[model samples]
Target: MGLLVNDLSVHGQFADLGSFAEAIERLMVIRQISLRFGRTLHCHRSLAHARVTATMTMPQAIQALAFEKRRAFMLWLTQHGPFWEDSRKHGPDDWIECNGSIVTDSAVGEAAWCCLNGIKQSLVSLTPSSWEFSPVPVDWVSNTGDKKSTGVVNHWTPAAIEAALQAEPAPLISWSQLDALAIARCTRLTFAADAFAPLNGLPFVSGAAQRLLFVLETLNRFKSCFDVAGQRTPEGHEIYHDFFTGKKEEGGRGALFSDSSDEEKSKFRSEMTFQHPADNTMSLFCSWHGKVQTPQLRVHFSWPIRADEPVYVVYVGPKITKQ
Candidate 1:
């Protein structure tokens, strides 16, 4: 449930690059869901090829679809084309009739593979050359468990997967492969409004603030332990962690959750570097922020911007630290 394989279940059916692109756009722009337009095409054609072509045109077609209907189309497409194809291959073209049953079966499998390949190619092409400062990036990074599909399909109900592996031509992937690829794409896209645009009225805050707020809210609801704080130096704001309760600075904002009740916090501490100071730290914690529903608060801090990091992340749990 918390891996990339889960994400691909949504996008693997796209027959070609076109539908794949449309699928991404639909999810990113108007809320990620199964779209309506894709379904009519899937139901009418009962095949991935036709579904793919129809999906490719969805961006424009969506303009005509009611905002509410878009999700229906996307969900229908997900439930129909890709799912069915992965479950089992279908009949072949007339030309293949001459070939023996075995050869024809091989042909169908080949077609399915090709369709999946097209989807992979399309997704890679659609990747933003670079991301601007946004809350959630479109693709998932390994740090956050978001994996891209490199033709490795790992999710085939255990029994089905076992069967596919035993089949001829040594299958390269399973249904689960699509899940990871899809999540990878999602992780890459940032969900935050483009810089200054918050859906409601407000300053829209800063990326750091938004991220810290998410962490605090999650811990509060779940009753998990965490520490967070920001410090101003002659250089800039340093938003480092104190791990366990340590000697407090003469003047400092204690970690978000630490209180007088807990005199000594754990000694273990760590730092999470972002792709950019502007990229913020929260995106690194949750694969995507907006996807989570909680409070609307942000953490403000001054830190050196690091672009080379490209979402660098580190984790340190409860551990004893010396002074």
Candidate 2:
């Protein structure tokens, strides 16, 4: 059984004030990861919107995946974590300390506040008696009217999130008991856009972009596959359906598609597809006090199939010895 947030909070009651403070300290890890996620998501979406007619390169897809992976972490934090408002009302100097160092960055502080707000917001979607956050409506599609859109929906209205906070509903997870689950795992997943070659472009767009769009569209098709309803289909058979059929313009089948040259098609199957398992790995990394660390405890973006690795990979860190 999972440790309920309420119980975890109560556990703090048995410890000294120092431990209580220490418990809150670890929350920085969660907060930092959420901030990165939000920033990346915001940046990528903005870029993709601007480059609407252009082909999405591997670099763009990697960044987009990075953003999504981060957003998911933020969702996890808000849906499951304990947060307390900072008592300090003044400048950065008046702040909490973890491991004898003062926490001063506005970035970290801003992320903490956003995370707390997210937690309050989540209660709006839950039934009072239910311990878990409410599941998203599977069939709920946005009214944006774009046929290929599968962007996330805003489930809780602002007023509802506010009401839940005002009532002081139970938290998703209390201080001191946050898991290394997905968060920790995401920190270790390696992401490199340059790992792939520049897949050839089609006359219309590029064969690369088409394949990428195909995977993105199909990823959400089986979202409800593992639901409470225990309907059984053939093993690995779910990969094929409306998304893959030649009838759909987006599907890769017999559409007016054939990116590879006739000469190329006869020689090699140039493009490939990727599928990630349910419990795949996705990790993010950073450095603290000059040592490399996976502070946020999250996994790498789930790896795409062989045919569509990201286009460009960006590396940020201090110099290190090559092994």
Candidate 3:
């Protein structure tokens, strides 16, 4: 489970990764991936995001990323839509560490935050390379829309994730514990909210049952940039982008539908209608680090998908080398 945000350099709102392909195509790939975030990321994923820098090649940056990431990435690529329901629950303190990220089991709640950060501007590659797919930007984090995460959700366990998979209906909003796990797996944020039930609708508004799905998809996204095993590095490798669809705009949540024909607008409206089920969502700016206020809810804007515009496959990181 994870949160896809706009440009991490400047703070932006949360964005759905539903249109993974179309949005990624427009991302600016540069040398330095920025680690600056609205909240602290898991140490392992933090390590992943920090690997981005202004000077290193994509491959040089994600050198230490593990293969489990690749496995997670592949699983996510094969599926579509929110993955929060499938996120993994863990021991009270299970955590992953990386030079850039420090993530643990207990702290994960609410918004899912997980991604690589701290590089140059969007879509600007530092050194020209021969990689087929260009490096686009994506990050991750965990969050909670309302309640404190208790770790255990509806009796679902880590073992459940590995076995007995059940089909989840379209995401519905509710105050289920899985939502807690989903919030934790996606991104890490400190915010306050009143107790309420999540209404049915929207991408993330649905119950947090998609946690495992988030983990799978995020790992895939994580793997795409890192490509730890050098399976498809530096050239026209399909590994970079296997899970993107132009559906995020189908909903009214994004900025892609601003210019459209009457018929297209109608279709867009028909497709759109889901809003996040929770409300009173606000950004928490903390000052204890002194006093500050954070804009909790925001949308990360990116170039919309255009019928006239052609999409191309591009790699987002340095080429991985065999050890």
Best lDDT goes to which candidate? 1
lDDT of 3 by residue, 1-323 (tens): 22222112211111322222222222211000111211111111221232234444223433333456434433332343123224322222222322234333312211222222111111111111211122221222222111111221111122322221222222333435433543455332211232113212323422132322242233333334424543445422332232221132231121111223355445544322222223335222111010000111111111222223211111111111101
1-323: candidate 2 lDDT, tens digit per residue: 00111111121131233332232233333234333333111111211122211243222332433455545434443443323222211134323222233333322222222221121111121111122233211121112321221111211233433333345423223111122221232232233432122221212211122223223223323222333344423421444332222332222122211122344434432221122222136332211111111111111123222222221111212212111
Whole-structure CA lDDT of model 3 = 0.24
Q: How accurate locally is residue 280 in candidate 3, as Cα lDDT from 0 to 100?
A: 35
- Compute the lDDT for candidate 1: 0.27
What TM-score does prediction 3 earn? 0.19
Best by TM-score: 2
Query: Clash totals for all models, in order?
Result: 44, 31, 113
Segments of candidate 3 deviating more than 4 angstroms: 1-175, 188-212, 215-240, 245-265, 268-323
Which sequence of candidate numbers ranks them by lDDT, best first? 1, 2, 3
* lDDT comparison, 1 vs 2, better candidate: 1
Model 1 off-target regions past 4 Å?
A: 1-213, 221-297, 300-323
